[model samples]
Target chain A: MREIFKQEIEQLGLDLVSMAEHMSSAIDKATTALEKADLTLAEQVIDADESIDEIEQRIDEQAVSLLARQQPVATDLRVVVTALRLSATLERMGDLARHVADVARGRYPEVAAAQGRSYDILLDMARQASKVGTQVVELLRTNDLALAASIESDDEVLDRLHEQSFQVVLDEDEDLTRQQIVDVVLLGRYLERFGDHGVSVARRISFLVTGDLTNAVAMVAETSPRNSETS
Target chain B: MREIFKQEIEQLGLDLVSMAEHMSSAIDKATTALEKADLTLAEQVIDADESIDEIEQRIDEQAVSLLARQQPVATDLRVVVTALRLSATLERMGDLARHVADVARGRYPEVAAAQGRSYDILLDMARQASKVGTQVVELLRTNDLALAASIESDDEVLDRLHEQSFQVVLDEDEDLTRQQIVDVVLLGRYLERFGDHGVSVARRISFLVTGDLTNAVAMVAETSPRNSETS
Candidate 1:
């Protein structure tokens, strides 16, 4: 029974890793689809989000089954429950990626980035967000302490870039239309929040590794900078 | 052992009820503060949020203890885990309420509501959101099927009101300032999401009673309208 539980735990981790991989791909493609105004790519990203949701449902069911069958205690139980929570976060990340795609799809035939600096900054922001997502998968797969620690810093980078994109949009000259300005606002906020959720995933992993939920919340609150006043 | 577990579960329900009550109060005061520009009321809401967080922590520790000590399986296991998830959502509802207060505090001496119609709409949204929050508490306490079924419909009301607030802010006919527009956007989004979390709690209760996760997500999706386009 113990060996069976171990195998189930291993399989759950592998499934989460695969789901995170899909999330990373969605982030990468969504931004590219936004930047290039590639309708097909954006459509593909939007279409792919269903799979992430499906993956979450799978992860959740398996976690519940483990809970029912094994009645895992202490850390083992926390791991199963955390798997449930983590899958929800990952699924939200996928939706955020899809929101990015939706922005791209909503503005097809025209890019959301109105300024050159905005365009450049958004690409960089999305790259950083995408990188952290992939890093989350790595952290989950290997439980590498150093890798999990770095995810927070990566989120900070994405946050900074998000702020820069906003500065670019809000300060745009007359060439940028109001609707386009709205689009940039939407895109930048989406990217910045993507970073926040990345940090949330890392925080969950930290709790899983350390068994300290309270401290994880505090650590994140202290380390992460706020850039509010956006819609 | 069974009766002891049952007693612990009942206590968990009571703690959640108290926490949800706090959340509902926060929502009420927050909207009033925003409309009246009442700094003291807003501060009260903000300061009260920490207690809600504390309640969630206590609930989490107790739930974890139950999971570890009792090793509850099947329905009992689902209930304990669902309590964990439900508390987190309830805490987030508290944060959303705090966010509404933050908006009010930030724009004190000047109402966060820029337009008369927008102000009225926001107040109504807050009332509806607060109503559903308390309704959720009752559902948890009683497992009332009627109350559980009604939350989704209440959320629909919030969605529509949120749409109205958006229309009012976005179509500001030269009367509203940019910052006020941003505040309305933020406030409206916060209220809408509060409603979403309310539905999530109801869904979890439904799942606890029926053990159907997929249908809950689908019910929320089919019933709730989308108002995305914001941060």
Candidate 2:
């Protein structure tokens, strides 16, 4: 019974990794959809979010069953709880990707970037965000605290690009309409938030490694838009 | 032991209610700060978010301890898991309130609404959001699924107001700067998300009553921005 329980716990971690991989793919394709004005790709990302969400639900049920059946205590119990948190965070990251896709779909043939306005900065943001997604998968799979540092720096890149996106829109003297402005704002927010969730998962990974509750608590606080809101 | 565990579970529910009340007050104050351009009130809302975060952490710690100590199964286990999910949803709601306060603080001495453009819709959004907050408290306190109906309708109202905000910003040819446009967009989103979290809590309550996991799963998907993005 103990051996079976240990395997179930290990399986839970693998499922979280799979969920992260799905989110990484979603953001990659969603950003591509945004970059190229590809409605088909955007629709695909939108449809794929359901599968991501279903995986989250499945993980939740498995985690709950592990707790109920095994009655894991100490380190074992924390593993189950941590899985639950990771699943929720990954699910949210997938939703952020879908929001980006929603912007692409909403714009249809018109690129959300709008004739390459802020195009370079947005591309940079997307690259950094995609990097964070990849890092999240690697972090979950390896449980490496060092990789989390890289994710934090990636998030910083995203934050900088998020700020630059606003500057580009606000300072543009050429043909920037209110609708385009709204799109840029929403897109920057969606992408930046995607990075924030990456940072959050990194912090959760820290908690899992160190068993430091402060890491998780501070993580939740930092992910709040209050910290990221434009000053 | 059984009686003590029951009390602990009851206390978990109460803690969630308290957290909801804090979020309710924060949004109310944050919206008032936006309306009045009262920097003091905005700062207060920002600072109060810490206490809300602390409440969430304390609730989480207590919930985990209960799970470990009692190893609750069946209905008791569901109660604890539901409490964890509720605490998280409420924490996110508080952060949404903090984001609204952040906007108010970011534009100190100048109303984020700026010359009353889209001000009415924003005020309507705030009012509905605060109402949802109140309804969330009632729903949690009473375990009444009927109130969930009211929360869902309130979310619809927020959705409409969210749409109207963009229309107001887009149509207004008078004195709308890019910064103000960005503010309206972010503020609209924060307030709308606040309502979404409220509706999320409503669904969790339904899950607590019915034990139908689909309600909770469907609720999370519905709250994703895909369903709410401006068409």
The per-model lDDT (C-alpha) reads 0.76, 0.85
Candidate 2, B1-231: lDDT as tens digits: 999998999899899999989988998898799889999999999999999989999999899999999999998999998888888989988888888888889888888867565877888898888888788888989998788877876688899889888888888575677888888888888888888888888887888898887888678679865666654
Clashing pairs in 1: none
lDDT of 2 by residue, A54-101 (tens): 899889999999888989888888889989998999998999888888
Candidate 1 versus the native: TM-score?
0.90
Q: Per-residue lDDT for A23 in model 2? A: 96
Q: Tens-digit lDDT track for model 1 on B61-169? A: 8998998889888778888888888888888788888888887887778878556677788888888877887787788778886788899667878888877776675
Q: Which pairs, if any, clash in model 2? A: none
Kindly give the stretch of ten consecutive residues in candidate 2 chain A with the minimal lDDT sum: A222-231
Candidate 1 displacement at residue B158 in angstroms: 2.1
Cα lDDT for residue A147, candidate 2: 97
The best candidate by lDDT is: 2
Quote the positional error of residue A73 for candidate 1 in Å: 1.9
Segments in model 2 whose C-alpha atoms lie over 4 Å from true places: A115-117, A172-174, A225-227, B172-175
**What is residue A124's positional error in candidate 2, in angstroms?**
1.2
Docking class of 2: medium
Evaluating just chain A, the predictions reach TM-scores of 0.91, 0.94
